[model samples]
Target: MYLKGEDISFGYEKKNRILNHVNLSLGSGELLGLIGDSGSGKSTLGGILSGYINNYQGSVSMDGKKIPSKGYNPVQLVFQHPEKAVNPRWKMKDILNEGHAVSQDILDSFGIKKSWLNRWPNELSGGELQRFALARALSPKTKFLIADEITTMVDAITQAQIWDIVLDIVEELNIGVLVVSHEKKLIDKLCHDVVFLDDINNV
Candidate 1:
């Protein structure tokens, strides 16, 4: 399956534009690196591609059809901040359960401890919380993953671990991944191809 965004353009206000006629595509099992400076609207494009920003101009389609307007989305997005993603009132187990039932093997692969499931979001470390976030995003129905600087807030070792788990899972599941980040080493190391925002955006 392919998620294609054609002529995507959006902005919060009329005068200022963030994304302008940006085109991008990711097929199953492919990993694409999106590199740009801060405030370059990489994350905004990711959001539009994933159906989070529906009011934007242009079109995003899965295969040849538009994405579902409701229910489970095949394109899953893992944001930079895990703390803001999950419900702080709920325990980790419940939060993970928001998606499909994650297996013990999946937890082990992401280095998520059994004990961590019982803790609140506030109780776990940033890396630990991020692991759960990744697991939740990798549900069986997910055809593509839009990782918008997911590991930027973590330490180097933790970032590596997260990326390793993500790569392994995406390979096994044949899920396409669009990694939006400013990390040059990471993009070079993980992406099959790299594209810069200015190359495709008409802005």
Candidate 2:
């Protein structure tokens, strides 16, 4: 397996478990959809898969080795709110090349013209910023991505365009993506397989 999580359970108080025995497995090039209601542990599960929350009961592994919670690389997450995920003061170029290599073509693919790189994050509209965020995440040596409701902020047309760019990048890089969303249509459109969070035992 490329990445796997088994019997994972977590909550703030040890006794109150928010996630109940969640299990998931992903191949190197799989795009898996995580669908659930608003507070059904969708973002929480994304956090676990990205190694942000490791205090859970069960096991999570990447490339068959245990996942390191602190300072872990190779995984990235794009949150639902671009403003929350991105640094308002930083330029798009800075976000992409933040001590890492980034290709010019990747920016171009996200509809970011060369001139736009010099502009701060605040200058771009929400849709543009989200696209840049996606580009930055894809710029690194990211093997897996946890996309947490990445299209919710944009209009329908922009969402379609952004999804296309993401799909293209994932195909080109052969990356695995855990796309978390409440939007069933998007999940059906992008995912190779779907994991319904409501079905905790099966997940």
Candidate 3:
């Protein structure tokens, strides 16, 4: 399977465009990196690919078919800020299981404690919440993952731990990943190929 974005273009307003005529593709089980400056619309492209933003031009398809608008999205997106992505009112367990029932093995792999499940989102550290966010996103039905600077807020040790577990799970599941970040060293280490947004985005 493959995820392809063709002639993609987007703008917050008519005069200013964030992305323009950008094309990108990722194959199943492939690890790809998207690198660009902080405000160069890397996250916008990721959002377009993952079905979060729908007001863009061009097509985003998987295996030559349009991605479905309803139902569980196979293309899952994990944001840089886990707190913003989840509901603060919900307990950790409810948030973790919002999409589907995550396996106990996945929880263990992410070092998510059983006790943390009962706590509120704010009670846990950013790293802890990110672990749950990732665990939830890596559901069995997920075909592709858009990781947008997912470890930017964590320490080096925590970042390494998170990526290690994520890489292992994605490998086992054959899920494609698009690692979007400004960190060149991390992109070089994790991705088989890298795409610079400036090279592809004609804005």
Candidate 4:
């Protein structure tokens, strides 16, 4: 399967354009990188691709078909701020299992202790919360993952560990990944091929 975005464009206001006729594609099992500066609309494009933002011009499709409007989405997005992505009122276990029954193997791979499941979102550190976020996003139904600077808030060691586990899981599942970030070094290290936002975004 492949995810393709063609002639995509969006803006917050009429006069202030962010993305302009950008085109991108990612095939299953392909690790693609999208590199850009802050406020360059990389995250916005990720949002559009993952079906979070719907006001954009042009089209986003998977395997030449429109993404489903209901039910579990094959394209899952893991944001930089995992805290913002989850509900604070819910416990970690509830949040983790909100989408599907996250397997014991996945929890074990992320080093998510059973004890952590009982704690609130605020009780865990950013890195710990991020592990849960990733674990949750990488469900059996997920076909493509759009990771938007997911490890930006974590330390170097934690970043490496998270990526290693994620890479393994995606490979095993043949899930395509779009790694969006400002860090060129990180992109170079993780992706099979890299697309600079400047090169694709007309605006």
Error of 3 at 154 (Å): 0.2
Weakest 10 consecutive residues, lDDT, candidate 1? Answer: 97-106
TM-scores for every predicted model:
0.97, 0.91, 0.99, 0.99
**Residue 28, candidate 1: alpha-carbon lDDT:** 99
What is each predicted model's overall lDDT from 0 to 1? 0.90, 0.83, 0.96, 0.95
Look at candidate 1 and tell me the lDDT of residue 24: 90
> Scored by Cα lDDT, where does model 3 land?
0.96
Q: Tell me how far candidate 1 lies from the true structure as C-alpha RMSD in angstroms.
A: 1.0
1-203: candidate 3 lDDT, tens digit per residue: 99999999999898899999999999999999999998999999999999999999999999999999998999999989999999999999999988899999999999999999999999999999999999999988999999999999999999999999999999999999999999999999999999999999998
Off by over 4 Å in 3: none
lDDT of 1 by residue, 93-149 (tens): 999988678888888889888888899999998888889998888877889999999
lDDT tens string, model 2, 85-121?
7677887778767746667788778878877789988
Which lDDT value does model 2 have at 103? 78
lDDT of 3 at 154: 99
TM-score: which is higher, 1 or 2? 1
Model 1 Cα shift for residue 118 (angstroms): 1.1
